[model samples]
Target: MIENRNEFLSKIAKQLGRPQPTSRPERNFSFSPQHQVLANATQEELVDALVEQCKNIHTKAITTTTADLVATLKQVVTDYKATSVITSTDQRFADFGVLPLITEHWPQQEVATHQWQERCGQDNITFAERADVGIMVSEMTLAESGTAVLFSDKDKGRSISFLPQNSIILIPKSTIVPRMTQAATTISAMIERGEQVASCVNFITGPSNSADIEMILVVGVHGPIKMAYIIIEDQ
Candidate 1:
């Protein structure tokens, strides 16, 4: 029994001499400029390519002045089957005449208003989930990359962009910049100027896609099936 105990203690002491487990250093992941699809396209070419892609998906691409965008959105909303619930964070959307057409979901609690985040999820499962499409307004868009950057503000939350089956973005042409670096610089400048940094800055290019499952390409797995960007220019 003494010999057995001694052997057990010796084994335990030997095992303790092994190397301690260590954690990996956190990596700074980044997008490579060399592989960025829209890094160098001219404005005309970028817009044309985007419009072509939009047409392939049966989406309407309309160019309007900032003044007319609101009126145009009203017309679009009027023609489409009006949803029981519509949600957005942009007050500029109010200028478009879409605010009255769809129920406004706010982030804050009013006398009767439910929280926007909760309403957004519920709307997704109930309205957006059942319906074919939903719409979101972008903070800014990068014309060079054909990317829509959505950030959380007073009215908009990130959940609205991520939880829906389909997402249509209304990007004002004025916000269209030539490059991502310029966009980042602008945002950082804004941050320095005391603008509250948003909880998330989602730079979306087209729709969510994956080629992970058996190396088969699939769209809309993580997000929308159809993603459309209407670059509303003040032409």
Candidate 2:
């Protein structure tokens, strides 16, 4: 079957009057002027654009200083009235001092962190499905489309981001880029460096929505109904 497929491909190439290329073609892959302009935007501009785009898509985008992150998170939790929360076990949450605050503020509320064995033992999927909110630290954010990039791993499980009623993503301002291309480039670099890339790299734009029936929009039918972004300025 493999030999037959190769022969068929060769015949098609011959019909096209060209040899099948054995190496990657060299070409200019630089961004256009408009894209370059966005790529060269200042940090403040990128953040502003990201927030604006997010809001336009009905996604809440909040900005806070590193010092006020904990306070801001408390405010968000209170505003949403989130009782049960699920989150990734990323160390950055601890480093930022947000995890302790969450535990302290919602002492009685069930807080589930992705732990391989423990998660499976406790049926983490069930917990996540019933969670009021799911929190995660975004690997990167794109300003042009207001997209948050998250890679699923043992610590950062896919369900924690998609199963809850609401999602709260913590994005460091430094990780915000101008466009998807920039975000893709960063991920490519990580792969080139022999990093263990996860099986799923989700690029979430906003809350899940579908307008297939009667032209009426339905949100969160397939995923989280509400999406919120907390941008940390001094990270």
The models' CA-based lDDT, in order, is: 0.61, 0.83
C-alpha positional error of residue 44 in candidate 1 after TM-score superposition, expressed in Å: 5.9
The number of clashing residue pairs in each candidate reads 3, 0
Poorly placed runs, candidate 2 (over 4 Å): 1-37, 108-122
Q: Report the Cα RMSD per candidate.
A: 10.8, 6.0
Per-residue alpha-carbon lDDT of candidate 2 for residues 51-133, written as tens digits (9 for 90 to 100): 99997777999999888999898788778778778877788888788867655656654544333224474577787888888
lDDT of 1: 0.61
Best candidate, lDDT: 2
**lDDT of prediction 2:** 0.83
- Give candidate 1 misplaced runs (Cα > 4 Å): 1-46, 49-61, 65-85, 103-132
TM-score of structure candidate 1: 0.61
| Residue pairs clashing, model 2 | none
